[model samples]
Target: KGYGSGGKVTHANVFIGSLAEGTSEATLKDAFSPYGMIKSCYVRNKGDQTYGFCEFNTVSEAEAAIAGMAGKNDWVVKFANNDAWDDEVPHSNVYIGNMTEGTTEASLRATCGTYGTVESCTVKTDTETGKNYGFVKFSTQAAASRAIAALNGNDGWTVKAANNDTGGGGGKGWGGKGGWSDGWVWQPGPSTRNDDSRPEGPPSDNLYVKDLPPGITEDEVFAAFSKVGQVVDCYVLRWDNLSACAALVRMASTEQATRAKSQLSGTIHESCFGPISVKNQEKNGEKLEDHVYVKGIHCTTSEDQLRSIFGKYGTVMWCRILPLPFRAGAGSSSVPDVAALVQFASPEEATTAISAMDGKVATEFGAPMVVRFAEEKANAKRPAPTPNNNLYVKGWPVGFPEFLLQSEFQKCGNVVRLRLLDNPDPEYPTCAALVQMSRVEEATMAVTALHGRPLQVPLPPMRVKFAGKDQGADNSNLYVTSLPRTMTESQIRQSFSKFGEIERLKLLTQQGKPETHALVQLSSPQAAAAAIRELDGSTPAFKG
Candidate 1:
């Protein structure tokens, strides 16, 4: 049937595409008014580009537009079931580029009307160039996808599917140009591929060991591989610590790491300190390559403790107890410390040591030691900040919502106010928030606790102080507003406990003689400072 001419429009949703630059919601409604009553039309902008979405009165009108202009040039139309609207909808938006100067929202909707129902359209002009590059959002993903498939890689104007909220594509740009590429050329960047093996030639490098314990040094590494062939080179990877010395023994050929796998794997070298195992490096015929690292250590703790902890996990290549670093201040520094690095014959062993003991306190040291993958150091200049204070937190659990900040800080003291910073644009949200405490001590405590913690929202790790005319000395006495009417004093107290001790709390109410917002007082300035650093301007109460 003709567009919206049949019985009451069946589809409440419709998609619009092939919009010209500078279209707007009012113009879109006027353009589509002839078919039937139009609902809301939404046109949005991306930088200088225009994009958006719109709703219609009937499904039949939507379907008619789709069928009539599925592959039409300049503009295309399609429809999607209302249920398809979600974070994952594909090709629901279009980007319009290369518009003439002085283009406005009305002009854009008229241009797009030639295709089908004109949803909201807008033409955004770059202030610097005074050029138009905007976007149009369709009511249905199907329409947007149809437009993109038809117009992509065509000609004059470049059109591609808009990146969806959940990150999908829309139609290609005008003239059917500017689309994604599917070619393969490797440079330097993150790779999604798992296997990276070359078809021809031997593997690049072989393994070698040297500087073993003088007594069993040579025989130690070779005895295990006697069946394979003669050992090529045997030495130790030396460092200042003699006890932590590592042995590198090269097999006659790369094949030895695989051929002597069984015997060399379990053979233990008897050293002054303890026994070490030998093992193959890799498997032949397999295209994959691998590397190894070793670590194991003991101090006053017995060798049995080391073996019991690390032995069952993986094959141990070598173990030694290196002397501790020399003290700096003359005679006072003369105390022995226990340090060791164990090299596993295979990477699996090294990984096991790291996984199991890397952070464990093997001896009676203060904190757990760190273990990580070693790599060559490249001297590259650090990146400059992108005009914003973005902080990165490391230890917090993922997906923690922003609301939890108040609860986290409640342990220390009373929170007077909290608010998350508002981004200038809704499409581009920011990560940082602001917090205020009743006491400086509470704020300080929060600052300390949240200093290295990951923000629930994405942001850099640094905390920004509250902006005020004075800008000096902490403001501990403060209040928060817009709290949910259901909130109680006990909940407020609990929320601020992490910051410090709360002196008192007063919830604002219209019934009270003195109309005031919620007020909280803390015991010390430290707590107040902590609260201010971590909880300011992020909560609903202080969002305004």
Candidate 2:
């Protein structure tokens, strides 16, 4: 049924196109009911066309109907657009590619017309290449989004918004979750970097140049590299407070890249850099591998925190933190800082993260972090300590209502504590939470039942597992570092004193370093955990 302007759609609704002749509401229900519990089903007529919608008990059910009905019996199934009925919203024009041979404008219009009013449709052939492409303009943005959602990546046809200005295909101006914007879909440029796992064609002839002095520009880099080969592109990547920077120079061919790398390796560009290292970008090898090794991690840091931090580079597949007492090797137990291995979807993303986060001394991270390529299983990981009552849950998008976590975890057992982990990078959408259950059995139940279970519609399944041994209930001591040498012991106590009584606060400083490390023991484990919660990554106000 058509919705008036400003009408909202629920996530559990599925839109059905090309309803069969003489089909009734009962027919739609009968077709979809096998997939899930159907809340409502109806067939509606607009003008001379007939369509239908089926509302299931949950979004998963609706998706099940789409998957089961799609490509069977010529059924066109997609999520119903909440804004589909609104005529006042901005309309969209789509760019369609990879059309089959001899496809006509009439056939294209017929396909898109099933989703919404096709205001105009056109097919064109590249005179020079004979490649056929087309465009479909819908009366409303919602209609175009629906058409793109159903047709994109289907039968080899690629459909997407013609431009970002249009309110279609996950662009701005779409009011709410509807059509293609509801779940993960395609967009363009850096904003859509979340799904870098998709094949992006073959590797290019790129060269990685490092040790360039600060303030190097793309033109400067191009001028230096172009002398040896035809330069396709150059990018100087930098971050705040960085002493030296790096650049990526793309040559026209791999042979040119090889020649340049062989000749320019360890050579200095007199104008812009010191003894620069020029190597084939792909040769760095890290750019082709997806795992990154992170060290100097604060003991209090969570895996979700690392995921969110590394996510700024690309989508993180998973983050595994090896808490103290859990080291790369048995002999490395003396290593004080925590360590983690984060895996991203793409090697390029992992490389980008290493470039950005390696030796990064940010306050939020609690210390300067060491990031680098992780050789396959570089650090042997031990299974998390079992019989653990604390659970670490992940797989929810950022900005999810954290308050809902307490109530949600209560379903399994008594929640002693619930803390939603922080994401320092605002742009990253993945988040995690830490839940302290009253009993080990309840935590096990949570892991068994909630792992891979969908808690919220349209969001990915929640990943629940036991946390590291250091995060267990019996731990009341905090291994804190990165404190200013002059900060004094009383100051450290005062900063965390509000949480509880400080039983012992010892500050240690190395001979040459400007920072000091501290070992804080509170009156109770609850007080220590509370102190970490409040001060883990924050700079508290300390008066002189």
- Model 2 TM-score? 0.20
Model 2 lDDT per residue over 259-374, tens place: 77767654544332111111112435544377777655543244555677778889988887663331111111011334567878987888888787664443343211111111
lDDT score for residue 123 of model 1: 72
Per-candidate count of clashing residue pairs (backbone under 3 Å): 109, 2
lDDT: worst 10-residue window of model 2: 326-335
Give stretches of model 2 more than 4 Å off.
1-26, 29-81, 84-91, 164-544
Report the lDDT tens digits of candidate 1 across residue range 141-221: 444544444445554445665543211111122111111111110011112132223222233113422222211223334
**Candidate 1: regions farther than 4 A off:** 1-404, 420-432, 452-544
* C-alpha TM-scores of all predictions: 0.24, 0.20
Q: Can you give the lDDT of residue 510 in candidate 2? A: 30
Global Cα lDDT for candidate 1: 0.41
- RMSD to truth, every model: 26.5, 25.9
Local distance difference test values of all predictions, in order: 0.41, 0.56
Q: How far is 381's C-alpha from truth in model 1 (Å)?
A: 15
